[model samples]
Target: MKNTSQSETISIIGAGLVGSLLAVLLAKRGYQVEVYERRPDMRKNTISAGRSINLALANRGIYPLQQAGLMEKVTPILTAMKGRMVHDLEGKQNFQSYGQKVEEVIYSVSRGQLNKICMDAAEETGLVNIHFNQKCESVNFIDKTMTLTDELSNESRQVTFEHIIGTDGSTSAVRDAIHQVNSSQHDIIPLGHSYKELRIPPGKNGEFLIDKNALHIWPRGGYMLIALPNEDASFTVTLFMPNQGEISFENFDTPEKVKDFFKRYFSNVVPLIPDLSQDFFNNPTGKLATIKCSPWHYQDKALILGDAAHAVVPFHGQGMNCGFEDALNLVETIDKYPNDWQTIFSEVEKNRKINGDAIADMAIENYITMRDSVRDEKFLLRNALAFELENRFPDYFCPRYSMVMFHRLPYAEAKSRGSIQEEILMQLTDSARALDDINYSIAEKLIKQKLSRVQLNPN
Candidate 1:
């Protein structure tokens, strides 16, 4: 742990996952920390109203949990998903391993549950203070004051702080405040895709009907249905689709239309959803967005992290993972510059923006890969070859999915490495297909060269 100057007082807004985890990390380092959340303590509450997709905690997210020493407490609460179980139109299932080994598993945990664990951990630190139902309305950086309103009482209060950190969500009030103060550079671009959550209840015997070790998917060309395992032996399913103008609820309103749509498109999982029509009609559709901003910090007194800084789509299953990583990175930066808050803020802004933009692009590209490319014959063939390559060269040629989801490689670096691996696989496949003149020795030499290059320069 790194010690910071005693003069610095850090106030974090929003007790969501990133904010709460960051509060713990900062407090552990002997900093005076306060966290403000707009809603009540989630442990006492039921389902959060509009949370669409639950979290799929991969290596990046798990590493932070371990660092915070909360992984031991939360690991038992998650269900492991080792691979993807793809469903075909005829109800046949195809298994695709996420990594070479089954131990490289992604955990399926509820967003609310994970947040509660982080909040409880932060509270236990005793060096941190948590304020619930306190919604930050504005920030006065000049005066170093934050004005917050009580959601229930409709009363307002002001508090003074040396520095403020905004982990407030995508539609963050602190972000809005930053925009008001610094207008020219910030922008939040909303992706046109909207998503909705549905459920697949457990069987009568209280057992999983589908394989619990795998994440289930029903890819429908333009749209897709995905399900993650739950501790209760049920599954939380989500559907991603275009909003009102493209495939609006109006056209999908009636039970007959909904039934026809599901039966034609996602027949394998349609029957599992008991209230298919009602769920489709009643559930609120969530809009996806990617937020881009220059200079995430507002001078030495304040900075933003988490969704407030970068909000990517869920296709890559990395929104929360990236946010958790943000907290870890921010703490490290602060540790590196214990005396100079200005330098820490500047460095975080510079590095985080690059990583954020890289992930946003990868997330969008993954949407296409998830919803469309899964059905392509060539893509499937290439995936098979990649798996075989991984088996043959266990330490060297890992699939890009394994690197991104099962390893701690940065998204930008993963994209670059994955692109090179793809090209090598294409060349190898082309050579192998030309069996009239077999070139096994040349292909093996080429693969070894590529592996050596990756080992030398893994960035």
Candidate 2:
């Protein structure tokens, strides 16, 4: 199987954010693409809402979209989230800036809308064909064929492919197929926390009820509620809590319990959502998990990307961004080895697996930071010191979150560097209560001794 011919149709399973964007990227390079999606086309259908946690689109995601020329289409749908707006129990609010630079911000976008945009862009290229409602039932690597079943008709058909890429999400059929023949394994690490989505409708004048530029958080140590502003002036609120515990989702079994929980903890949010109980019961509680798989590819015939390969918890807001990076990296790999797909697949897996694992760990850590650490005075002091350190030593020091969100550095490198930076912050802030209380002499010595100057974007 000489898999690199541009004339050969590349079959991509799961016409999701990654797959759809990949189709556009491949089609641009003159390859014909066929995208198989199990769900109906969202543009033409009314898909159920409330399950999707609003995506936080950052620089890593934006760069790929810009490269694909889809940023123009995507920009209008984004709501810039400057930083976390911590909402205390007594209704007091504090804003924490994500970065000192004005440009360092993340945008909140609907997952479905962004997917639709990518799908539309892919179709616009005229070289990509998206077959909606066609579920990929199975893949046969030895035979180079797959079984696609029509969701509406319950009819199955076999389609041969030169190469297949899976972007079908965490519970991927394509990954399962590859697992049968490959020695590599995959793991799904659950965070033991579940989330449910609720909405805060626009005000009477169709204005935002909260600060439109920030992501709101009500961190309660054990459980937390977050809200992101949407394009329609509404806020998409999500509650993350344990699955089974004293203050878990199981405890809020009734409407009264749910409403009472909100009034007690998320008191400020209670007034915004009048039908809180109705929304709580109506929306489903979604699980939070990280999918870690080694060797996201199978020879020259098949590969997997995005959530299908590395699904991280949404705490870091890089799930979509990471998937988009995978798409970009794959396309770039194809560009380098245009005719040898086995090499390309091998290179992608080797390069991406570590980064994927790093982000997974960071996202899980961020869950705790968002739910508990943000409320601590020590945490705030260190966060501020991190920015000041970056200001003082531009090349040598960058905050871990900033590196992940604002730059294209490998997640593995970011995690490694962030670990060293954390040690520096701990030492610098161990005695200091504020920025003025800190000693620059000790900080400079520590940063110089432990860290090396880094290129912001190696891409």
**Which candidate wins on TM-score?**
2
- Residue pairs with backbone atoms closer than 3 Å in model 2 (clashes): none
Q: Looking at candidate 2, what is the lDDT of residue 266?
A: 90
**What's model 1's TM-score?**
0.93
Instruction: Show pairs that collide, candidate 1.
Output: none
Q: Using Cα atoms with residue i matched to residue i, what is each candidate's TM-score against the true structure?
A: 0.93, 0.98
Q: How close is candidate 2 to the true structure, as a TM-score?
A: 0.98
Tell me the tens digit of each residue's lDDT in model 1 across 253-292: 6888878878888887877889887887888878888887
In candidate 1, stretches whose alpha carbon ends up further than 4 angstroms from where it belongs are: 47-50, 244-250, 391-396, 430-459
lDDT against true structure, model 1: 0.81
